[model samples]
Target: MIRRKDTRRMAKRPTKPTKSVEPRRAGRGPSPEKTAQTRRVIIDAALGEFLENGYADTTMDGVARRAGVAKGTSYRYFPAKEALFEAVVREKIAGALIDADPANRRPDEPVSTFIRRTMLVSIREIERNGRAAIARLVLVEGARFPEMTEIYRRAMFEPLLKQIRDLAATARARGELRRPELEDYPHLLIAPIWFAIIHNGLLDRAHPLDIGDLFEAHLDLVFDA
Candidate 1:
């Protein structure tokens, strides 16, 4: 006897749905604030390296290490050590020049008074703000690295000297200065500042002369104020 085959079809089981995943986008670049912060850190690190090791000894690797950044990061911001040094001077030292700009002088303000208010204030903060250290670095390494010296001279010295000359002419015109000698020898006004810097930094650190006071005394002699 042949058995009749069952004609009923079995129901199929349901399969679990698969989860969809989106492809990740390429990593984004650093934000502007982060980039600026990194640049600032590199500059500060470079200054420290220059001050501690001198320009000849400072290296991009050392600066990057000091900054706690990858070597490539520092190089990305400054292609070479010379560029790093220039950045240091521009950020740390050149800003002080703004205070000494003759254009900042108010109308009818005596040149001596303007100097007292502006340059004097900057001088007082030099040692405290690390400018004195940078100046010493330039003095010590200038001969070997003339390019560094030129950077400093162009960024600071030339502009400052021109400002002094202009102010000297203004002082004489205003009768704040009685002699035209200052117009000829404007360095006379700033000689004491250099003396104080050298004295305090090199000659006799044990007996540091207050640069601000020394500069003010020189002002009195030059302007007879």
Candidate 2:
């Protein structure tokens, strides 16, 4: 009787498996997030190197060392020195555009105040850091690397110029300013700022007029009559 009971068949049952775990967060390692961070690091390092050493003198090995990356890894990211240099210049110019925020264009802000704030920031960046060198690099190598120059002109300079001209037009409409016809004299308007920036390192160079005061004075000169 016991042997016959053991021969009885059992009903089939479904088995429930345990839940699968997620992959661990890779903090600043070689994962996607880390790769993006590493790429930024390489770009920043290359920028500093190019600013200090100029494009011709900047090398992949030097940038790799500065970024704490292997040459192979740097090459994997940038492929070549020209590519890296273009990226570095583009990054710097892009940063300027982001900082400018021309679209947030406060047409209501006093033109003098606007010009002061904008020019002061520009002058500080151009003088405090080796930004002049960055600018020079872009201009000189831009012909050779059209991409970098195009990014500089289109993204950084053009937007600001358009914003300024637009703001001037608005101010003129409001009778707040006599049009200097600034659209026709972008360089003349911008030159004082650049001249100050360029001669910042020189001793006994006739300092360009106090930019903050001068911009306001210029505004008054335009609006008064």
Candidate 3:
């Protein structure tokens, strides 16, 4: 019953200090969504700058200004004007190529029919979606900027032409195509598209040609349908 004798029980032990946790800061780099958004903004700005000023006059600084991003930001996405132009072609123009790719054709679908469904639809919307403007830009500035021309050709032209050649072979094998000319001249399939693009854009701005109609008419003649 001598409770006062027990000094160990009488004295309260000191409590240990709890460790403080530091608040987590977000990562310094941009998130994936933010990065994609930034890239889209830069690409849109670059396209507008290239269209307004032409490739020769369009500068990375100008594109950044248009994008409202720091010049370095654009450089991070696109190292040079050529690279930016390539991106524009790949993103904006090359997408249509997928629609017309021969690989997407049904086993029984005629080449002409497949093109009418795919390439024709894309051609119909080309002007509405600003693709015609990009094509016009390439046409107007391609000579002055061979690098830009090469980028367009490599990204949009070659792949599409190759697809056309493949389709031509398939058509001939299936008896849908009567001539070997398409295989030799894949450009024939797209000739009307270029002509319509040129005629509507430059030759007759007052009386624009319907690219879809022109391409459809060309198809009729080529397929003899």
Candidate 4:
């Protein structure tokens, strides 16, 4: 489901290590949540700068101005341009990861229900979050920023891949899913969802894709033989 970089924003690292370095230890000040929020705001503004002025053209100063923060504040969050880029990409991808987790679901629910709920959450995340812009950037501009792609593949896409893999394994174990190509079923089921989301952006248009119908049809096609 990766896109050409020209069309979307590049993916970010899924987590930030440096952000965990407490400012209190560094003799700098702010509540942890405040620091996190400020970091997010800076990353958002930096993304805007990168988009408006291509990555090559964007600068820390521009990002600072766009963020309405002092240049020093921007530097505090992302000392290097590469770091800033990574932070921004991670910020977006982490949101997707959060959406994919199904801990909110009831414990007694069926696996199918859990999967359906997770997929619906994912659909909502893709629709409402800034995924379109990020996906397009990754496809088009990502080649120039290899780090971004690496972050995306490892952090963002890999988790989703693992989730599908686990779902397939669970279904097979439960006798609810049987396919000569069992492993591939997960890919077949999930790929279209990702592609549909990406294609929506590429075409510069939006339309609702039915997650429930798509999931059920795939399950029926693969497992109902």
Candidate 5:
């Protein structure tokens, strides 16, 4: 049920943070809705630049050009290029965090069913959000942008890890899982999703593996009775 659209507004950060742009000097430059929309356009365009050119090559000018706005306008919305990168990565982190929320699952759902659906939500996010490009960007530039990596880990990865840990705890309490180790090692439950991402994103030319099949086998292996 977790779709891509639900991810953008997940965080309530103010969209119009810097001084008003577009020369609306009489104070309130643009309507709140318009300001938010412009900020989103900038974020999307910056994502394109970052995805295509990588971190080092992407520039504020490129993002502004892609967004069809003046470079000053882009800077008005985002104080620096790193701010744009933060915006680009924020949506992905939000999507992952939203998918990890246990409330999204149906009440009293079977553990296996809930787990499958949860993983599928993430899969859909990846497929819909060009996650492959972002993954590559992070892998290539993560050492330089430790803050970005920290943002992603704290906002998305750690939360999702907690969710899986919670699920494992519940299953263990209910005697559904014979493997108490799952509670201690919930990372094992989600490893295959990354493996699938690597296959599809990095090397699908020669070793194309169906993601659905990979997840199914992951579940069977983990939920072994």
Candidate 6:
């Protein structure tokens, strides 16, 4: 068997070595728990960092460094700073919506008690996480990037609205509400609570009116004693 000289020369030529495979934990392939934990750390760290640093100044590397994960890990979880900020909203702010579920109402609990507990829990979360700072962050960033608004609306607003609306209708039927007219406007029922939150967020002090008085007024205005 005779082969051409060009074929012999081709056979003698050395090939490039394959790239080495990265270790699993080193941003190559992380476990599900590890991945979730990484995301949690990033979100926690990013939220704090953003609150401290403002939006334009926030960098993915800063979040990764704060999270104690590699920069690539932060990027692996989120592609851009916008995505990271959006995750901050979803994780810290919007995630509190879970407490608003009607399922959280205790069996045979008074409607007044349930309303106070639910709204307070939400307010506590908003204040604990950064209050007006977080609210302002969402609004400021959401203005530039509208996806934050949609994420907030779907994640936070819709579920809570449905729960409160159902509660309103139930209260009206049971004659527990003084203002059945407001049942169709469940948002009005909760609007006072949010006003208190927004007031604290923006004013950084009491809004002249005693919040307790205001809340009691809200209850009086809408509910039967």
Highest TM-score model number: 3
Query: Candidate 6 — which residues are off by over 4 angstroms?
Result: 1-29, 204-217
User: Model 1, poorest ten-residue lDDT window?
Assistant: 4-13
Q: 1-225, model 5: which lDDT tens digit per residue?
A: 865777667868778768656854575568899989899899889877887888889899999999998999999989987777777777744566675566776777767788777666566556457665676567668899886677666666677788889888887877779988878987887687777777777768477666667777888877785
TM-score winner, 1 or 4: 1
Candidate 6, pairs of clashing residues: none
Q: What does candidate 3's lDDT look like per residue over 52-168, in tens digits?
A: 887889999999999999999999999988899899989988999988888899988888889999999998999887788888888997888788789988999999999999999
Q: Write the per-residue lDDT of candidate 2 for residues 1-225, one digit (tens) a residue.
A: 445554335645678998999999877647888899999999989988887787778899999999999999999999988678657655655455454454554857765566556654665555445566666667667787676677667656677677667656666676767656664555545555555444543433465445444445554665565
Q: In model 3, how large is the Cα lDDT of residue 31?
A: 88
For model 3, give the 10-residue run with minimal summed lDDT: 1-10
By TM-score, the candidates rank as 3, 1, 5, 6, 4, 2
lDDT by residue for model 1 over 1-225, one digit each (tens)?
999665554545688999899999989999999999999999999988888888888999999999999999999999998888888888899888888888999998888889989999999998888888888888888999899899999888877788899999888888888888888987887788788788988999999999999888888888874
TM per candidate: 0.84, 0.66, 0.84, 0.70, 0.78, 0.72
- lDDT of candidate 4 at residue 223, scale 0 to 100: 57
Candidates 1 and 4: which is better by lDDT? 1
lDDT of 6: 0.72
Which ranges of candidate 4 are over 4 A from the true structure? Answer: 1-28, 50-57, 102-108, 180-185, 203-225
**Residue 115 shift from truth in candidate 3, angstroms:** 0.5
Clashing pairs in 1: none
- Once superposed on the true structure, which residue ranges of model 5 sit more than 4 Å away at CA? 1-27
Report clashes for each candidate as comma-separated counts: 0, 0, 0, 17, 0, 0
lDDT against the true structure, each candidate: 0.88, 0.67, 0.90, 0.69, 0.76, 0.72
lDDT of 3 at 128: 87
Q: What is every candidate's alpha-carbon RMSD to the true fold?
A: 8.6, 7.2, 7.3, 22.4, 20.7, 6.8
